[model samples]
Target: MSHATRTRPARTSASARRTHTELLSVYLNDHLAGATAGTDRARYLARSCRGTDLGPTLEAIAGEIAKDRRSLTDLLRRLHIPARRYKVYAGWTAEKLGRLKANGRLVRRSPLSTVVELEMLRAGVTGKIACWEALRQLAESDERLDPAVLDDLLHRGHRQLHALEELHREQTAVTFHASGPQAPTPASRGTGAR
Candidate 1:
């Protein structure tokens, strides 16, 4: 048979195609879970930091995060991938549990809280950048994936990361370097000469 009549080596069986889709669905669902947690955390941090230097920036980033999550949901729907609700619930629960961390304050927001939360948000944004890039690669072969949309998401993720890093640094300095009360005591720093 001629090259044109060779049937293109069967073009992957339907079962194999289904498996591929299933795996992609699972991967996207995992990211969706992370997105849920990140969105919740961002909103909380924004609210906590309200009236401070980081307030407006954190609030803006939180809104962008919610928008990103929606975009991911839309992509899943377009690809006919059903989101696993349990994973999303787990994400939400995890964010809630994160608040229980001891930050040297029992009744009020610790300075440490802002620093740590910004770091976590930064990490989430980094992951989101990776996710968008991965989907962008798939867009080359999958008509359901949109390269332009993925590119826009990637751009926003980078912007988010930069903003988070700035907030993290500012909060870190305030939390770790102040002298009024939150500063580390000399004994807490150990008696050894330095």
Candidate 2:
């Protein structure tokens, strides 16, 4: 290949770049809103978890999640991606709704509740890893984002996923195996009902 081609950045028309940037900004913001809700979940878990083993760990994870959300907003500012308030509100509302799901019990806490929430947190962390990876790809071409920062965010996402997965396993085992190994029926499973 010619040196010019090898060294030259991939080219797109100005209009195309603008359109792509606009789309990406919206997409990132949507995911940012989701991440915001994930932080809420972490905070809720930290507060609601009464178990001696999971409580402190969940609190620490909640702190980390808050930091991650702050880092994301900072990145958005650096990129000139305007924050959409409505999306943020929507995310918060969704998290609140998630809390109302039935978890085998009517008025009291259920072990299954923790298991389900942990799984949701794990899913969010998975998405966070993807978000960081997407931005890391742009870091190669976009000057506003630091590759090192994205790398750190990705690393933190991995750590969050690891912690969440551990909690998920422990919670599921505790929730379903209270007696012994048994087949989970529809009612016994996470159907959000008794």
Candidate 3:
């Protein structure tokens, strides 16, 4: 809202929190799913949080906007994943983030390599763990499994994070512009010289 608020930073070691922060960026962009949003980079940036770590700061920002986790997470159900700001990812441990990046778990060229797929795998892993535990409890003969609640939890973890996927498309579309070599500049095309 103000310059002072914009400059605020959360207090933690540069090394320790950077990974988590980048992880948060990955998570957020994943949550937004990278639709055109409102055509405002400022709006697309989202997360006008107060504290450090874009995650908590996002929560903080939501608070300023009169929204909390329950409210935001609720909206999360329908929103496309958000785009990760490369600058934020820059702060993380290079090796681990590189693994994440190169693995295409954060960003990638192919559809299968995107983070959403990884998160879905993670979700499936979590679901299997829970399903195993639920089966174990079922075997115990004391409790009954509610298919509805179990399905909800399973879906939460297994949900596809489409942010990176959308970002991939959005970025590829830009490559044809004057910025990247995918397209030629006016001078190179001889259009500007005439």
Candidate 4:
């Protein structure tokens, strides 16, 4: 190999040399132990990285911040990146999280149908209680509704009454494959001569 090819190139201009020296000093200062640069510094680095490849620029700036000590979180914040936790509803099975429509119909599945039914029951019971109190104060009161029947109200709407009256209406989307495993057929006993 030629010695010229092996040797580092000399800076031809004093201005160019100054820039290189400054860049190197920043790198070393940030690289040193216990030297922490703030978000302002990181922003400057990201801004300086424009018009250049992001990977190399980010890497170079990251090197200046800390060779191995800086956290990705710190770096991102320094770049003025906002902290926003995305609400992803993709493929999650959490009940009441989605009300997606599909196949020209809305559908709901039971995770705790009894609990939801009970909540509705509680509301109805509360209303009934209020009415009973009012009626007792007045002259009109029904003796049939024992007012203490809230305990059994949870199971009151357990049956499919009136084709989906939908006491606590909820909905979500789901995808499923129709193809199932093929079943093996039994051998013919007559042909095989039992």
Off by over 4 Å in 1: 1-12, 180-194
Q: Write the per-residue lDDT of candidate 2 for residues 90-165, one digit (tens) a residue.
A: 9999999999998899999887888889999988989888989999999999999999999999998899899889
Best by lDDT: 1
lDDT of 3 by residue, 1-194 (tens): 68656555443356556775466445544333221111111121233212322334223222322221232233334333244445224322331332343433344343333333334323323433354344334335423434444455445324322332344354345443455356675767866654
Candidate 4 ranges beyond 4 A from true positions: 1-108, 140-194
RMSDs, each prediction? 4.0, 7.0, 20.2, 31.2
The TM-scores, one per candidate, come to 0.87, 0.85, 0.22, 0.18
RMSD of 2: 7.0
For residues 46-120, write the lDDT of model 4, one tens digit per residue. 454445433253334334334222332333243233322221111122112322323243464333432233233
lDDT tens digits, residues 11-127, model 1? 556668878999998899999999999999999999999999999999999999999999999999999999999999999999999999978999988888888888889999999
Which pairs of residues clash in candidate 1, taking residues 3 or more apart in a chain or in different chains? none
Q: Comparing candidate 2 with candidate 3, which one achieves the higher TM-score?
A: 2
Q: What would the TM-score be for candidate 3 when compared with the true structure? A: 0.22
Pairwise lDDT winner, candidates 2 and 3: 2
